[model samples]
Target: MDFKYVPTTCPYCGTGCSFNLVVVDGKVVGTAPFQRSPVNEGRVCPKGSYAHEFVNAPDRLKTPMIKKDGKFVEASWDEALDLVAEKFAQYKGEQSSVICCARASNEDNYALQKFGRCVMQTPNIDHCARLCHASTVAGLAQIFGSGAMTNSVSDLADTNCAFIIGSNNFEAHPLAGRRLMQAKKKGAKIIVCDPRRTPTAKQAHLHIQHYSGTDIALLNGMMQYIIQNGWENKDFIEKRTVGYEEFKKNVMQEKYSLENVSKITGVPVDDIKTACQWIHEAEKTTAVYTLGITQHTVGVDNVRSVGFLQMLTGNMGKPGTGVNPLRGQNNVQGACDMGALPNVFPGYQKVTDEAAVKKFEDAWGCKMPAKIGLTIPEMLDTFADEPEKLKCLYLMGENPIISDPDIAHVDKALKNIEFLVVQDIFLTETAEYADVVLPAVCYAEKDGTQTNTERRVQRWRKAQDGPGESKYDWQIIAELAAKMGMGDKFPWANASEVFDEMAALTPQYCGMNYERIEKEGLQWPCPTCDHPGTKVLHCETFAGMPDGKSVFAPIEHRPPAEQTDADYPFILTTGATIWHWPSGTMTRRSESLNRDCPTGWIEINEEDAAEMGIETGDIVTAYSRRGEVDVPARKTPDIKKGVMFMPFHFWECRANWITNTPYDPVSKTPEYKACAINVKKKEA
Candidate 1:
């Protein structure tokens, strides 16, 4: 196997396992973890191990295409770019909202926002993060100074206790989950707080079966117990944190009693007390969570509550103890760090500020809107609930039709989009109804840098010149800008120049350059050419950390968007499977991935299945107020009695269609957790 071993970051989970691209004879073959690298130690998962298969898949789109006469017809890049620019130009202003979704690199995401604010003349640009981690960011920002994770995955091993709530880390972040096990082996107690006994909880020294959406109450109850027993670290609180009295007065009061929290979270009172005792006893404790805590209406508050607990116990800043949110994607942390959110420019600087806006405006030679932008869910609302306000939408690398809340409403928004341009490697579910489709290059076919969960910015080398007639997304964006009369505005030779401009304009990437990351990857906030990028943040001080303080946003518990009533008895929640990416654009095409986990299946508790007269492998109809989907049921004990888990990766079983669209007023992320539904045996 004559191949070049180029080092790069894994494009799957945010764990950002560094690996080498097994390029055999200029054709990408497979991925191998960097053995010497401490993280993962040369280990890979079912998803990360076979990431190379999708690169050379025969089903990949190799040319620009326009939807004409009910079919995709090959067209020049000019045709698609003109349509996109003309439509965007028509609605170019503050009223025109643009919400970018899943997929796309940091560079592509930046171009999308610039196109929206400068050319489209609107501050209305958001990302799919609204659906995944908006609340995590928002909530973390409120409690801590920044929204990203406080500690790295390596810190998990050093902790004396790990409070993992609302996360199936074992299945989602396998390598990180193994680290948790290692922590357990080292006498670091593992606290698994979820509705089901997941693999992470199976070996857990302590597992608390908390009800969905009651995380705040459960965490508060633990804090209440800790406070009453006077188990908190007094020196750490006095020296490092603030707002202890307010937290005690607010959450430690009666509403968060053990009985009440037990009632809200569905955990036993004894279990709650035990968890509090364990956390109190441990010298250093870490809290790691995922979408299980972020996809709800009170997502941000749920996160804040966790931070409050961590602060109350002084389990932050030290190794093995901090608030660590295991991000869903490889670059989600980096994406946000690079200023992918609408309200904040790169490095999480506020876009509304004159100085910040001026920095970007001066760099682009264009004025940016002073106001904030609409979120993904908000854009969908404007289309269906509002009016013809949302007419044309150009999606770079997202599949909202299947991934967004209330899949039916998302579909309506797509139908209403007079001009829809979907740019991707393959025909995704969201691309089924597009005015034009631009053939975009995948990660393996391009050269660029992606920041991982650890905030490490690593290089991705071009293994092969793009497949067939395809072109890199960055080049496509430059072309589109030129055709749209911004040609003189966006004249770039390659992605490196584009990234350099982006890095220079954004404060976080101020000092980083290609040469700096030439050998080993560099973390952001490098600040100058002479500095090595920061490995761990808050080592000394936090970024504008809450007045060098923590804000305790105490919130009352709220029910999920849709509750279980007589008509809809069972509650259905949507999530991802290890085998698929967002909407299965690339996953379904991979032969090995398909062979291992081809179709999607609904997971139900054995008791619920027996009561509903459903057996394993029995196809059933799952319906809610919004829509209905038919999928085979695998009755397992992985879920709670009254709840079911479904992987929203397949189109045939549109889980989002049956999901509730009611969103958190603050973050606007839909409550995909607790929608009510009924399961019935399909007639043969």
Candidate 2:
């Protein structure tokens, strides 16, 4: 028995934990800890431990398939690629769109985006980041000139106070949560702001249970109280930030008073004051949040409010202080860095910038589009409304049918597309609608790099061979580009060569190479060969502004896009569970994870359940303006009254069916956290 352990990064969450894939006789069988990892230090979450289970699952996509007579039939790579290339050739510029994958490697994303711009001559490219951290990218860029987590993940352990809002890190991002636990063990104060009494909230010294869509009000109230008591860091604000007077005037308004904010957020005035006091008293405080803060109509406002609170308290540039928006997927950060978004090229370079476009065009030997492209929601909307305008879509590794808001509408939009090509390791729900389905390799069978939430760039070492006929995502893209007469533009021999080309174009990754990050990974802003990676941003000066100071946005609270009515009297929110990852593509295939959470359920407050004659385990029908779903009811006091919670992992009870479609104007992120719904016990 030939056995060996291969160290690689976890392909689950953005925490970027490392583990050794247990390979026996050329097959990945299990995972062991890699102690030298800087992120997890030999620790991993359940998803990471069982990540290998899905690689060799029984239903793995082994060959390419093409839809014939409304049913899929196995086909050779030449036949599928020829058909795809022929169909794609019919659509050019804005008529085509490409959806990259966050779960794929950085090399794959960079090559795919280059294909979209140079070969397809279209800027309509994006990934799951639009659904998760688009607000983080937009809001932080406006305030601090950067749109990523400002501090390292391990820095959380050194924080004196951690203000965790909108995210339950203990369940959503376990490894990062472990850092907060370490801080707690060292006497650091842990303050959580959330409506549900999550495990993380229960462990907090203070849990401010604010209502959904009221983040701006809660943050404004805290800032108001801080300024009123003269607890704010005036020196820091005056020296390191601008627009203080206008921001102060806005937050100091009587409408944002403690009592008013309490009425709006459902959080008591005393609890709000206590949270503010803890943050002010701590020497180093970090503001941590996730989708609960970004998946709203005011997502950008909410994120900017968090930045305001941190900057107001002089917590911008220290080791244990900064606004940290933990990414949901393994390589969502890397995907964004590789220019998977519509508006920017790699390294956040604007697509409209002539210089940047010229540089890429010269490098690729092709002219590129200068116009910014549509986001995921916008693409779907265009497909549904004007299918002729955006006719074809090339989606890789994304399951938008279950992940997008108002999936009922998503289903309609997908059906209207002229042509759809899906590339993945499985025949996902979304892939079922594809004209062609291409089998792709998973992380364990690929050699690449992934950027974590803290801007750390880590390596993913290949441990085993891909299933039969399955190809790397970049390889498929390159072959298609070759078929379309752009083979010269993609002449890389391996993933490392692809990385070298990408690093040459991206300023942030200009110095990064495979040799430099072979063992422990290096964080971004490592702009030179000899320079150490950056751990904290904006130390002496803000990078976003020309004046070297952060700017404050004077934002006011706005209610959710869809408010509760007499017919729909409850607020419904969607999220992920600890057992399964998003869309349940990989995790659901894992026997252990599937056994733990075999189905979906809605969390209802005990009082509400009792009032509606609903009991735990009872089938409940939840109805919204958009759609309805029947899920088992879980009556618990952990969730606030007048609100219901459901995870989006189960396809049988898709939470997105009832989620609101209205998105943030700035971030284009749907308001998944606040939608009006009505529920009742399902009759037999």
Candidate 3:
């Protein structure tokens, strides 16, 4: 029996844990711990352990298919590519949009975005980051001149204090949560601010159960108390930051006082003070958060407020300090870095910048569009409201039907499009509406690189051969580019060639090569061949600002787009579970993961469930202004009363069906964390 272990990064959350794929006689069978990996330190979460189960699942898409008579029919790759190319030729400029995938490798995203610009000649390109961390990119860039995590995952162990808010990293990002525990073991204080008493919160030294949509209020209150007690880092603010005078004046207002903030956030004034005191007392305080802070109408404001707090407390630079926004997917950070967004080229070189456009044009031998394109939300809105504006959409490895807010509207937009194409390992709900469906290989069957949440670029080594005619994402894109008459621009022979081409153009990755990161990944800003990767950003000075000093944005708290009222009396929020990842595309395919958490359920406070005569496991219907869903009820005192929690992973009970569509003006991130909803027990 020929057996070998192949090392690759986990394809789940952004924690970037690495494991060895157990291959038995040339087939991937299971996973084993890779002790040398600094990310997970030889330990992995349940999802990582079971990640290989879905790679060779029976339902893997093996052949390309084309729609005929409103039904899918197997076809040769040439036939499907011909049809796609024909359809794509009809839509040009703003009429065409490309939705790249976060699950795909950096090579895949870079190729797709390049194809969109040179072949289709459209600026409409984006991925799931617009929904998850667009605020992190926009908000942090405005403050610190960069939108990525300022500290490495391993740095959490060196923190003196960890101020966690709006994230249940213990479940969503287990490996990252492991780092927080390491800090605790070293006598570090953990302060968690969340509405639910999550496993992470339960382990906190101080848990401030704040109300939903009140992150700004809670943060402002803490800052006000810190300043009132003369704990603010006046030296850092005066030397390393700008706009502190206006920011101080804004937070010192009576509305931000501990008493008013307590009323707004439903967190006790003393608890708020305690949180501030703990942060001030600590030598190094790190602010940690996730979608809970970035999935609201005021997501940018919330993120900026966190940045302001860190800068005010002198936590901008050094180990175990600065703001950390954990990404949701394995390559979501890579997707953004590869310029899969609407407004920027690779390395965040703005499309509007003539110099950046000219550089790319000279490199690719094509005239690129200079105008900013539509984001994901804007693309969907155009599809639903003005179908003619965006006639064709090419989606690769993205399941927007289940992942996007107001999925009902997403369903409509998918159907309304003139031409739709989906490429994935499986026929997702979003692919069911596709005119052409291309089969793509999973991470185990592809050789490429994926950038984790910390800007670390790691290699994804191919462990086994893909089933049937399925091809690598970049290969499929290259083939389509060839058919679309841009073969000269995409002359790369393999993933390495693609990476070399991308690194040459993106300044942050210019120093990295496959050889340098063969065993262990390296973080970004490796600008030279001999330069070591950066672990902590802003070590000496901020990079995002032109003046080498961070700026402050004095923001005020804004209520959620939809408020609780007589019709919808409870606040509804959504998140992921420990056993399953977002949308349940890969996790649900794992028999073990599916068996553990079979379906979705709504978590109602025990008091609220009791008042409604509802029992655990009882069927309940949650109603909002847009839509409603029937799900099993789970009564738990861990959750606050007047608030409902649901995991948006199950299709039978989609939480996004009732999620509000109002998005942040700057980031365009939908308000998935807070909305108005009412729940009632289903009668027999």
Candidate 4:
């Protein structure tokens, strides 16, 4: 009986909490807290604590499986790989698409993009970010010159004021929640703006519940209030930013006045004034937001509005004074950094840029495509609308069937594709439609690096071997690349070799190497090995902007694409609770996690529940324009009247079944936060 504790980062949210996987005789038994990590100290979330159960579960895909006549049958790796290669060969350029997994490691994601562009010869490669925070990337990049968290995770502890909007951080990012609690202990004012009284809101000094899809209005109102009260930092604005005059001119318009804002959003004028005062009066204000701000039809506008507040208050380029987005997946930051998006290569180097394309082309020995590829939603839509356009789809570690918006449409797209290949640890919902399902190893069975919400890149070591025949995500991609006769371009011997190649290509990670970060991690924009990683960005100037300044984008509020009517007289929003992770891919497989949240339910306000004669735990059927789902009703004062909330985690009661598909024109993120629906007690 060999007992050892292998330290690794949690494969849950973007908190980047460290834990030690307890390995006995080459088998991972459980997780123990890693005490020396700077991010979480020695603590972890509930999902992280019980995350090990799925790794050794009996349901883990033990071997490759190929679907014939809609039935999956066990097949050897060669048979599966050969079939995938053959099918992918039929598709070229835009006809082929790949969905990289944000949860996978940097090496895995880097390998995937290379495979998609070089082997499959398509620029249509994207990940789950298209669903969650694509707006943050698009908007923040346009504003601050970089579309990532502007502050460090630990910097929250030093903040004098923390304004949390659109995020239930306590449930979504527990470590960040702890840091906020610590900051509170040190006399930081915490203000929360959400439609629901989230657990984080309960801890805030002010919890202002505004109407859904009114984030732009609320933020513009707050800025107007500050400007009217002479709270704008003129000196900082003049020196550190550009386009403030235009922003002020637009925001100071009577339409954005407190009364108008109050009418647009349901928040009282006094409460809006007070929220603005808190930020204005503070020495340093840090604003944190999550999917609540980004998963909207106007997601980019929502994000830019948040950035406008920070810039208006001169709350940037310092510790605890920037717009921070608490990312979702553990490696989501890394996935984006590794260039899983369609428009960019590794390090966000634009695909259309001749120099960037030439760099990759010179490195990989292939002339890359100049055209920007279709996004995940666009690719899926093509398969549905023009089935002949998309001939092959290769998915790695993503379950789009349950996670993507408009489940019926996604199902049709999957079925319409000529060839579908899914690579994952288990037979997920999306894998069900696959022509071939490749078995891939989980994080514990892989050695690679993951970047957290703060852009801190840390090493996650392999604790034990994966289940039978399962390979690391990078290994699987490399195997397919080799079979496709692109082995020379992807000659990585191992994950580290893949990382080395990626680091050489990505400017942000150029300073980092596996050996340098063996013990401690380093944040990106570390351009050289001699230079220590940057803890805070924009200290002097924004990285990619032409001038050393930021911009304020004045945006107007637009109603959600779908609004409640007499037919569907309620607003339905989708989210995740602390008990389960996204789509419940790994967390749902855990016995302990399942025990805590055995099923899915809809949260309705007490008033709505009372009016409808509905009680807690009563099964209810919810209907929308697209589809319907049955779930248990959970009455709570935390929710608002005429509103319903459901977590899109359980497959048995997929909340996305009834969710609308309206997306942001700029960021292309589906408005998972708001849609029209009607509900009633299920006939039991």
Q: Candidate 3: lDDT over CA atoms?
A: 0.93
Candidate 1 ranges with C-alpha deviation above 4 Å:
95-97
- Worst-scoring 10-residue span by lDDT in model 1: 94-103
Instruction: Score residue 482 of candidate 3 by CA lDDT.
Output: 92
TM-score of each: 0.96, 0.99, 0.99, 0.99
Output candidate 2 Cα RMSD. Answer: 0.7
lDDT of each: 0.78, 0.94, 0.93, 0.90
The predicted structure with the larger TM-score, 1 or 3, is 3
The digit string of per-residue lDDT tens for model 2 on 575-628 reads 888888999999999998998889999999999999999999999899999999
> lDDT score, residue 489, model 2?
89
Candidate 3: where is the Cα deviation over 4 Å?
Answer: none
Q: Model 2, 585: alpha-carbon shift in Å? A: 0.3
lDDT of 4 by residue, 109-202 (tens): 9999998988888999999999998899999999888999999989999999999998998999999999999999999999999888889999
lDDT of 1 by residue, 1-684 (tens): 677887766777777776788888888888877785556777877777888888888878887888888898988777777777777677757557655533566776666677767777776677777887888888887767777777666768888899999888887888888788889889998899887777888878888987677787888888888888998778767766666776677776787898888877788999888888888889888889988888888888878888878878888777788888888877677667656667987777788898888887887888778877777877787877765666666677788887887877877777877777888888887888888988888888777777766666777777776787888877787788887787665767877776787888766687887788776667776778888876566655555674575555556666676778999988787777777766777777778998988888888999989888899899999988888889999999878888888888898887887888887777787898778888899989
Cα deviation at 339, candidate 3, in Å, is 0.3
lDDT of 2: 0.94
